[model samples]
Target: MSTPLSLDRIQHAPKALLHDHLDGGLRPATVLELADQFGYDDLPATELDALTEFFRTAAHSGSLERYLEPFAHTVGVMQTAEALHRVAYECVEDLAADNVVYAEIRFAPELHIDGGLSLDEVVDAVLAGFVDGERAAAGTGRAITVRCLVTAMRHAARSREIAELAIRFRDRGVVGFDIAGAEAGYPPTRHLDAFEYMRGNNARFTIHAGEAFGLPSIHEAIAFCGADRLGHGVRIVDDITVDEDGTAKLGRLASILRDKRIPLEMCPTSNVQTGAAASIAEHPFDKLARLRFRVTVNTDNRLISDTSMSQEMARLVEAFGYGWSDLERFTINAMKSAFIPFPERLAIIDDVIKPRYAVLVG
Candidate 1:
């Protein structure tokens, strides 16, 4: 067996994150500070240590409702423009510290309306935060670029409005649209009008499918809704079959995914936490990687999963016996799958991510 790779070494490697949630990754201290500013005492814990404990407990419940509970607190404190800007700025700072070179942070703008700010105002605040964060990181000789993905609540009825909001801010900072929230009862097909509109405008989009649901959801998102990428498409494993001699047979769906080159944003720890996979040891990331599927690693919710890109890569290294080459492949997959313009993506691959990895493996 190969010697296990050191997590600390991987921590310094360049990384990209595509599936993180804004509401799901607030710093505990920031949450407490924001809560105090708003005069809200509904927090389960007042102190930072206790607050961290509360969040850990809430996330480990493995129930979707419990996992969503912390968002209420985070969102409650993020109603005002100032609060939103602070949180978004801090998110970028944290990602830079973790050595992430590029990230696409997503949030549902509709969730931040308690202070009567319009949807545009909320997005503008977050965009301003990213701008500030980029400047701040540059001061420390490290830089990170952030793009916003406006998400629509799947169970809600504002997808069309949210899609339009994404298109409106496309030139500013918003790069793409997504549909988030509970995936069981709320199908992606419900937002067909929004997807159609985005398509008409030549906008890009990714759909959260096959995470909590199954292959049917993925099929609808791609075929019916025209998703450019598949978020947590892990459940597509259900479409595969194992032969008697340990050979794997690609089902029709798996073959299609491979042939079409659709990227799978696989979040290992979060998938395990959400019961989407049996365990990290049994995750299909290795299988998909071996099968040449376009797979990328991500931290779906850093706070909820208690993960960073470094930690996720460390786990994959341990679980799948992956080497630095595998890590490079994952980064290339993310760069290829990103919703950014072709020139920007090419610059990242050639000038930033690839050069960093080349030095690492030298």
Candidate 2:
């Protein structure tokens, strides 16, 4: 067997990420600084280390609702355009440090309106930050590309507006649309109008389904709303039956998901933290990868999960004995599944991803 890749090696490997949250992944020090700058005094901790520990501990509550509680502080500080730009800029710098060559970070533009910034202003500020970050990374000899997915909170009533906003800024670094929030009470079908609007405009979108809920949620996201991808579709494992001798059976939904090549944005650590799965070892990523499903690894919430793409890859390597080739496959799957145009995706794969991985293998 080949040697297991070290954390340093993993950090140096080229990677692609599809399912990361902007507000959910802020640096603890940034959170504290932004909070102080904005005069928001409801933080759970004062110092940076304690604030970091508080977020990590709070996210381990095994309840999705509780897992999302820390966002209030992050969002509280992100009301101004400057705060949004700084957060977006630092997100790129952090991802570049971890060697994520391509990433699509998602955030709700509607969430930053409390300080009187328009949705357009919010999108422009974040886009400017991405442009600046990419240029800075290039100067440092790291060619990282970043984009945005404008998200709408599912429990709210602004999905259609968010979808239109996403379409309005598609060429300006906003590549897709999404809806994310508590999944128990507010279903994906509630935003059918928004999905239809995106489809009508030929825009790409992914839905947060099969997480904190069950099969029906996945079914609606696919069958009814026509999701381009399933965010945390890990719960689709419920439809698969593994026999004693390792025979596998796929139910109708699972079969359809596999047959259609729908991407599953599997975030293993975040899944375990949210009680979506028992543990990292028990995550459906292994089974789904074995099944030849379009599975991609992700750090759903870097801060809350206390993870990076390298960290996620290392955990999978330890759990399933995955090798460098396996990591390459996941990276390729993510690139293919990105919401960018076909030719750009091909260029990234052929020019950036393949060459980088070949050097690593050599």
The top-ranked prediction according to TM-score is 2
Question: Where in model 2 is the C-alpha error above 4 Å?
Answer: none
TM-score of 1: 0.98
After best superposition, candidate 2 residue 351: deviation in angstroms?
A: 1.0
Backbone clash pairs for candidate 1 read none
lDDT of each: 0.90, 0.94
**Local accuracy of candidate 2 as per-residue lDDT tens digits, 1-362:** 36888899888899999999999889999999998988989999999889989988988988999999989999999999899999999999999989999999999999999999999999999999999999999999998999999999999999999999999998899999999999999999999999999999999999999989999999999999999999999889999999999999999999999999999999999999999999889888999999999999999999989999999999999999998789999999999999998999999999998998999889
Per-model clash counts, in order, read: 0, 0
| lDDT at residue 350 of model 2 (Cα atoms) | 97
